[model samples]
Target: MRILLASPRGFCAGVNMAIDCLDECVKRFGPNIYVYHEIVHNRYVVDRFTRIGVKFVDHPDDVPVGSILLYSAHGVSPEIRKAARERKLQTIDATCPLVTKVHLEAIKYARDGYNIILIGHEGHDEVIGTMGEAPESITLVETPEDVDQLPFGPDAKLAYLTQTTLSVEEAATVIRRLEERYPGIEHPAKEDICYATTNRQDAIKALIGQVDLLLVLGSQNSSNSRRLQEIGVTTGKAAYLIDGKAELRPEWFEGVNSVLVTAGASAPEVVVEEVLEHLRQTYGATVEDAITREEHVTFPLPKELRVLQAAGA
Candidate 1:
C-alpha cells in the first residue's frame, strides 16, 4: 500500500503558542491551574493537561474567587472576561490571534451600525465568544440556506465575519449567497479563516485524487478536523476522523491500496506518528509527502507569560 502524508497538517502556530502558554503556567504556578475551556479541541491534549493538574471549567463561576484562569485558544467574549474579573480571577488569555481578529471585526462592524452575519457552526465555543462581542447585532449562519433565513432586508447595512476553522469552499458558498442577497454587504479587511486551516485543506485537496482512502487525526469536536474529513468525503473518497491509530479499523483497508493521512491544527505530531507506525506495521505502506503550501506563521506567547518569563530571567 502507498501512504500519502500531508505537509503542514498538524498543530498550527496558534495552537503551539496556546500549548506553550499552558506549559509555562503549569511550570510556574504548579498544580490546579484553571482553564476556561479546552485549550484546544483535541481530547488527547486536554487529557494530558488534566493528568497534570489542570482544571477545565465550563463557567467562570466554577472557579474559586482569586484563582488563576487561562482562557482557551478559542477566545472568550468580553462577557466571560467580565465574569472572571467579578470573581477576582487572575486571567491569562491564550486566545488564538486569528480568532481574536474575528472578534475585533465583529465589534467594529457592529459599532459602525452594520448588522453582522457570522459564518460558523452554532454553539461552538469560538462562535459563541465571537457572537457575544455584539450579540444584538450579529446573526449566525451555518450554510447558504441560512442566508435566506436572515431577518435583514436586502438594503440593510451588513458585514460578514467567519470562524477561523471553516472550510474555505463552504465559506465561499455562504459568502456568495450573502453577496447575492445583499450586494452592498461589507467584509473584513482580510479573510477570517486562519492560514493553517486553508493550507491543510489545500493539501488534502491535492492528495484526495491520489488516494483511495483518507484518515484525519483529530477529536470529533475539532472544527477544522471535521472540515478536513468533509472535504475528503465531498471529493467522493472514503474518509474517517479518528482520534488516533487505536480507532482505525482493519476493515477500512479492505479494498484501499492508497491512503492519505492528515491531522488537525490541535493534534500532536506524536499521535500522527503512531498512526503512521500502525500503517507501516499493518500494510507495509510506502509513505510520501504531498506538499500544498508551506507555513511559517508563529504567534508569540501571551503577554502575561512573557512578563513572567522576563521576571524570572
Candidate 2:
C-alpha cells in the first residue's frame, strides 16, 4: 500500500519553543517548575512533562509567590499577566509569536475604538487570551451564522482578528461574511492564522485525492488536528484523529489501499513514526514523506530561560 504524507505537519514554532523551554527549565531548575497551562495543547506533551515534575496550574494562586511561572504557548490575557505580576511570580512567556501578533492587533484596535470581531472557538485558550486583551471591545464568532448575528453598524470602525489555528476555509467564509455585512471592516495587515496552519492544511488538501484513508495524529481537543480530520472527511475520504499508533483501528484499513498521514502542531514526531511503523507491520505498507511546503520558522527561547542558560544556572 502506498502512503501519502503531509508536509509542515506537527510541531510548529510555538509548540517547539514551549516544549524546549520546559525541557530547559526542568534541567536548570531540577524539575520543580510551574507552568500556567498545558505548555501546549497536546496530551502526550503534557503527560510527558508531568512525569518529570513540571506542574501545570490554571490560576496564578495555584503557583506560589516568587516561583518561576511559565505561561503556555497559547498566550495569556493581559489580566492574567497582571495577576502573575501581583503575585510576584517570575514570568516566562512562552506564547507563540504568531498568537502574540493577534493579541497586539486586538489591543491596537481596541485602543483605536474599533469594535473587534474575533473569529475563533470561544473557549479555546488562544481565543480566550486574545479576547482578554480587550474583553470589552471584542466579540467572538465561530461561524457565518455568528457573523450574521453581529449587532454592529457598518460604519462602526470594525476590525477582525482570528485564532491562529482555525480552518482556513471556515475562516475565509467568516471573513467574507463580515465583509458583506460591514463593507468597511478592516483586516489585520498580516494574516492572523499562522503559516504552519495554512501550510499544513494546504499539504493535506493536496493529498486528499490520492489516499483512501487519512490518519491524523493529535489529541482530540487539538484544534488544528481536528481541522485536518474534517478536511479529509469533508473530501469524501475516511479520516480519524488518533492520539498515537495504539489508537489506530484495524477497521479503518479494511478496504483502504492507500493512507495519508499527518500530525497536529503539538504532536511529537515519535508518534508519527510509531504510527507509520504500525502501518508497515500490519499492512506491509511502503512509506514516503511528501513535501508540500518547506518551513523554517523558529521562535527564540523565553528571556528568563536565556539568561539562566547563559549564567550557567
Candidate 3:
C-alpha cells in the first residue's frame, strides 16, 4: 500500500502561538494557571496541559478572583473580556490574531448599523465568541439554504463575516448564495477563512480522488478538522477522523490500496508520524508527501509573555 501524507498538515501558526503561550505561562506562573477554554481543540494538547496543572474553565466566573487566566486561540468577545476584568483576574490573551480580526470586523459592522450575517456552525466556540460581539446585529447561517431564511429584507443594510476555520469551498458557496439573494450585501475587507484552513482543505482537494481512503488526524470537536473529513466524504471517498493510530481499524484498509493522511491545525506532527509508523508496520505502506502549498506564517507570542521575558532577561 502507498500512503500519501498531506504536506503543511498540523500545527499551523495560530496553534503554535496558543500552545507556546500556555507553555510560557506555565513556566513563569507555575501550575496554578487557568485557561478560559481548551487552548486549542485537540484532546492531546489539552491533556498535556492538564498534566502540567492547567485548569480549563467554560466561564469567566468559574475562575477564582485574582487568579491568572488565559484566553483560548478561538478568540472571546468583548463581553467575556469585561467579565474577566470585573473578576479582577490577571489575564493573558492567547487569541489567534486572525480570529481577533473577525471580531473586529463584527464590531465594525455592528457599529456601522449593518445587519451582520455570520457564516459558520451554530454552536462553534469561534462562532459563539464572534457573535457575542454584536448579538443583536448578527444572524448565524450554516448553509446556502439558511441564507433564504434570514429575517432581514432585501433593503436592509447588511455585511457578512465568517468563522476563521470554515471549509473554503462551503463558505464560498454560501457567500455566492448570499450575494444572489442580497445584491446589496457588503463584504469584509478580506476573506475571513484563515490561511491554514484554506491550505489544508486545498491539499485534501488536491489528493481526494487519487487515494482510496482519507485519514484526518484531529479531535472531533475541531472545526477545521471536521471540515477536512467532510471534504473527503463529499468527494465520495472513504474518510475517517481519528485522534491517532489507536483509532485505526484493519477493516478500514480492506480492499484499499492507497490512503491519504492529513492532520488538523491543532494536531501535533509527532502524532501524525505515529499514525504513519502504524501504517508501515501493519500494511508495509510506502510513504510520500503530497505537497499542495508551502506555508510560512508565524505569529508573535502574547504581549504579556513578551513583557515578562524582557523583564526576566
Candidate 4:
C-alpha cells in the first residue's frame, strides 16, 4: 500500500497562537489558569493541557472569583466576557483573530439595522459566539434549504456571515442559495472563512478521487475535521476522521491500496506521523508528502502575555 500525506495539514497559525497563549499563561500565572472552553477543538491538545492543570469550564460561574480565565480560540459571546468581568476574573482572550473579525462584522451589521444570517453548524462554539454578538439580530442557517426559511423582510437590510471552519464548498453552496433567494442581500465584505480551512479543503479536493481511502486526523467535535470527511465523501472517496492513531481500525485499511492522510487545523502533526508509522508497521505502506500550498501565517500571543514577557525581560 501507498500513502499520500497532505501538506499544510496541521497546526494552523491560529491554533498555535491559542495553545501558546495557554502555555504562556501557565508559565506566567501558574497552573491554576482556567480556560472558558477547550483552547482548541482537539481532544489530545485539551487532554495534554488538562494534565498540566488547565481547567476547562463551561460556565463562568463555576470559575472562582479572582482566578485568571482564558477564552478559547473558538471565541465566546459578549455575555461570557460580561460574566467574567462581573466575577472579577482576570481575563485573557485567545479567540482566533479570524473568528473575532466575524464577531465585529455581526456587530457592525446589527448597528446598521441589518438582520444577520450566520451560516454555521448550530451549537458550534464559534457559531454560538458569533451569534451572541447580536442574538436579537442574528439567525443561524446550516444548509442551503435553511436559507429559504430565513425570516426577514425583503428590504430588511439583510447580511450574512459564516463560521471560520466551515467547508468551503458547502458554505459557497449555501451562499449561492442565499444570493438566488435574496438578490440584494449583503454578504461579508470579505469572506469570513479562515485561510487554513480553505487551503486544507483545497488540498483534499486535489487528491480526493486519486486515493482509495482518506484519513483525517482530527477530533470528532472539530468542525473543520468533520468538513474534511464530508469533502472526501462528496468526492466519492471513503474517508474517516480519527482523533489519533489509536482510533485507526484495521478494517478501514481493507481494500484501500492508496490512502491519503490529512489533519485539521487543531490536530497535531505528531498524530499524523504516528498514524503513518502505524500504517508502515501494519500494512508495510510507503509514504509520500504531497505539497499543496505554502502557509506562513502567524498570530501574536495575547497582549497581556506579551506585556508580562516584556516586563520579565
Candidate 5:
C-alpha cells in the first residue's frame, strides 16, 4: 500500500504558540497551573498536559486565587477575562491572533450599530467566545438554511464574521447566501477563517483523487478536524478521524490500495510518526510526502508568559 503523507498537516503557528506558552508556564511555574479549557481540541495534547500537572477548568472562579490561569487557543469573551480579573487569577491569554481579530471585528461592528451575523457552529468554543463579544448584536448561523430563517430586515444595518476554524467551502456557501439575502451586508476586512483550516482542507481536496482512503489524525471534538473528514466523505472517499494510532483498524485497510494521511492544526507530529510506523509494520506501506504548499505564519507568545520567562519564574 502507498501512504500519501500531507505536508502541511499538523500544528499551525497558532497552535504552536499556544502550546509553547503552556510549556513555558509548566517549566517556570511547575504543576497545577490552570487552563480555562483544553488548550486545543486534540485529546492527546490535552492528556499529555494533564499528565504533567496542568489542570483544565471550565470557569475562572474554579481556579485558585493568585494561581496561573491560561486561556485556550479558541479565545475567550471579555466577560471571562473580567471574571478572571475579579477572581485575581494571574491570567495569561493564549488566544490565536486570528481568533482575536474576529472578536475585535465583532466588537467594532456592534459598537458601530451594525447587527452582526456570525457564521459558525453553535456551541463551538470559538463561536461561543466570538458571540459573547456582542451577544445582543451577534446572530450565529451554521448554514445557508439558517440564513433563510434569519429575521433581519433588508434595511437593518448588517455585517458578517466567521469562526476562524471553519470549512472554507462551507463558509463560502453561507456567505453567498447572506450576500443574496442582504446585498448591503458588510464583510470583514479579510476572511475570518483560519489559514491553517483553509490550507489543510485545500490539501485534502488536492490529494483526495489519488487515494482510496483518507485518515485524519485528530480528536472527535476538533471542529477543523471534523471539517477535514467531512471534505473527504463528501468527495466520495473513505475517511476516518481518530485521536491516535490505536484507533486505526485492520478492516480499514481492506481493499485500500492507497491512503492519504493528514492531521489537524492541534495534532502533534509525533502522533503522525506513530501512525506511519503502525502502517509500515502492518501493511508495509510506502510513504510519500505530498507538498501542497508552503506556510510561513508565526505568532508570538503571550506577554505574561514572556514576562515569566524573562523573570526566570
Candidate 6:
C-alpha cells in the first residue's frame, strides 16, 4: 500500500491556542478548571484531558461558584458569559479568533438594523454562539432551499455571515442563493471561513485523484472533520472518518492500494502517526507527503493567562 499524507492537516492555530489555554489553566488551577465544552471536538483530545482530572461541563451551574471556567474553541453565547459572571466564576474564553470575528460582525450588523443571515448547521456550538450575539437579528439557514423560504424581499437591509468551519462549497451555494434573493445583501469585509479550513480542504482536493481511498482522522461531531469526509464522498471515493488507529478495519483496504491520510484541526498528530504505523505494519505501506501549502499563522495565549504570567501569579 502507498499512503499520501496531507500537509496542514491537524491542529490549526486556533485549536492549538485553545488547547494550550486549557492546559495552562489546568496546570495553574489543578483540574479545578471546568471547560464549558470539549476543548476541541476530538474524542482522544477530550478523553486525554478528562483523564488528567479536568472537568468538562455542559453548563456553568455544574461548576463550583468560584472555580475557573474555560470556554471551548467553538465559543459560547453571551448568555453563558452572563451566567458565569452571575456565579462569579473566573472565566477564560478560548474561542478561535476567527469565530469571534464572526460574532463581532453579527453584533455590528444588528446594531445597524440589518437582518443578518448566518449560513451554518443548526445546534453547532460555533453557530449557536454567533447567533446569540444578536439572536433578534440573526437567521440561520443550512442550504439554498432554506434561503428560498426566507421571508425577506430583495430590498430588505440584509447582511450575511458564516460559521467559521463550514464546507467551502456548501457555504458558496448558500451565499449564491442569498445573493440572488437579496442583491444588496452585505458580506463580511473578509471571508469568515478561517484560512486553516480552506487550506486543509484544498489539500484534500489536490490529493483525491492520486489515491484510491481516504482516511480522515476526527470525531463524529467535529464540523471541520466532517467537511473533509464529505469532500471525499462527493468526489466518489471510499472515505472514512475515524478517531484513530483502533477504528480501522482490514476489509476497507481490500482493494485499496493507495490511500490519502489526513486529520481534522482538532485531531492530534500522535494519532496520525499511529494510523500510519498501523497501515505500514499491516500492508507494508510507503508514505509520501502531499504538500500544497505551508501555514505560519499563530495566535497568542488567552489574555487571562497572559496577565497572570505577566504578574507572576
Q: Report the lDDT tens digits of candidate 1 across residue range 1-313.
A: 9999999799999999999999988988886799998999999999999998899999899999999999999999999999999999999999999999999899899999999999999999999999999999999999999999988998999999999999999999999999999999999889999999999999999879999999999999999999999999999999999999889999999989999999999999999999999899989988898888888999999998898788883
Model 5 Cα lDDT, one tens digit per residue, 32-113? 7999989999999999999988999999989888898999999998899999999999888999999999999999999999
Tens digits of per-residue lDDT, candidate 4, 173-221, equal 9999988888888987789999999999999999877789989999999
lDDT of 6 by residue, 126-145 (tens): 99899999999999999999
Q: Compose the digit string of candidate 2's lDDT tens values, residues 118-171.
A: 999979999989999999999999999999999887778899999999999999
- Model 1 clash pairs are none
TM-score of 2: 0.98
TM-score per candidate, in order?
Answer: 0.98, 0.98, 0.98, 0.98, 0.98, 0.99
- TM for candidate 4 is 0.98
lDDT of each: 0.94, 0.90, 0.93, 0.91, 0.93, 0.94
Candidate 6 TM-score to native? 0.99
Off by over 4 Å in 3: none
Cα-based RMSD of candidate 2: 1.0
Off by over 4 Å in 4: none
Candidate 1: C-alpha RMSD to true structure equals: 0.9
| Model 4 clashing residue pairs (backbone) | none
The model with the greater lDDT, 1 or 4, is: 1
Across 1-313, the per-residue lDDT of candidate 3 in tens digits comes to 9999998899999999999999988888898999988899999899999988899999899999999999999988888899999999999999999999999999999999999999999888899899999999999999999998988888999999999999898899999999998999999778999999999999999988789999999999999999999999999999999999899999999999999999999999888999999999999999999998999999999998898899993
